[model samples]
Every structure is written in C-alpha cells, then in structure tokens.
Target: MNKTCPNCGALLIKDAWETVETNDNGSYVFKSYLALKCLQRCGYYERADQNDQE
Candidate 1:
C-alpha cells in the first residue's frame, strides 16, 4: 500500500509493525499492522513510546 506524505504531498512507502497484544479475555496474540512513511527523509516519521508498543 502506498501513502501520501503529509508534509510534501509525495508518495510514501508502506511498512509493517509486529507486536504482542492481549485481549480482554487475557489471551496474548501476535499482531501486525501497516505503517506509512516517506523515503526521502522528509522527517514525517511518527513517534512511538515503550508504553505504546504494549
């Protein structure tokens, strides 16, 4: 999947992030999600904290 850069209106590349997640039932599962970013060093990267990963 391609994404548009929010800063320069250019096309961005797609990437995936994987991590373990727990549901309300207390079951743990490995999940993946798509992320988008500019390849030309547009500084459009989104920040994630340690808490956000869990």
Candidate 2:
C-alpha cells in the first residue's frame, strides 16, 4: 500500500513483502510488508489515495 504525508502531502512508497502466518486456530494467513515514508517539508507522512495509484 502506498501512503502519503497528511501534513505535507508527500508521496510514500510501501515495500510490501509476502509472508505466511499461523493463527491460534492453525490457519495460515498471508501478510504483506509495510514501509514508512520520508516526508519532505513538514516531515509528515500520510496514506495515498486510490487516484494517486499510477
């Protein structure tokens, strides 16, 4: 998922990684990795919108 800075409206790139996890019920779940953003200006980061997906 891509995120942006709410304060500064900076573009952020999320490096998602695939991984498997077992729950208490012995169920396998897939999870992706998340990344932080380096906000410019105000040093704030927020999630990007669907329209931002290009």
- Candidate 1 residue lDDT tens string, 5-52: 789877766555577989999999997766555777686754334433
List ranges where model 2 is wrong by over 4 Å: 1-16, 34-54
| Poorest lDDT segment (10 consecutive residues) of candidate 1 | 45-54
- Give the whole-model CA lDDT for all candidates, comma-separated: 0.64, 0.56
Model 2 worst lDDT window (10 residues): 44-53
Candidate 2, residues 1-54, lDDT tens digits: the string is 456666667766543345699999999999654444544646443343455444
Off by over 4 Å in 1: 16-34, 46-54
Q: Please give the lDDT score at residue 51 for candidate 2.
A: 55
Could you tell me the TM-score of candidate 1? 0.38
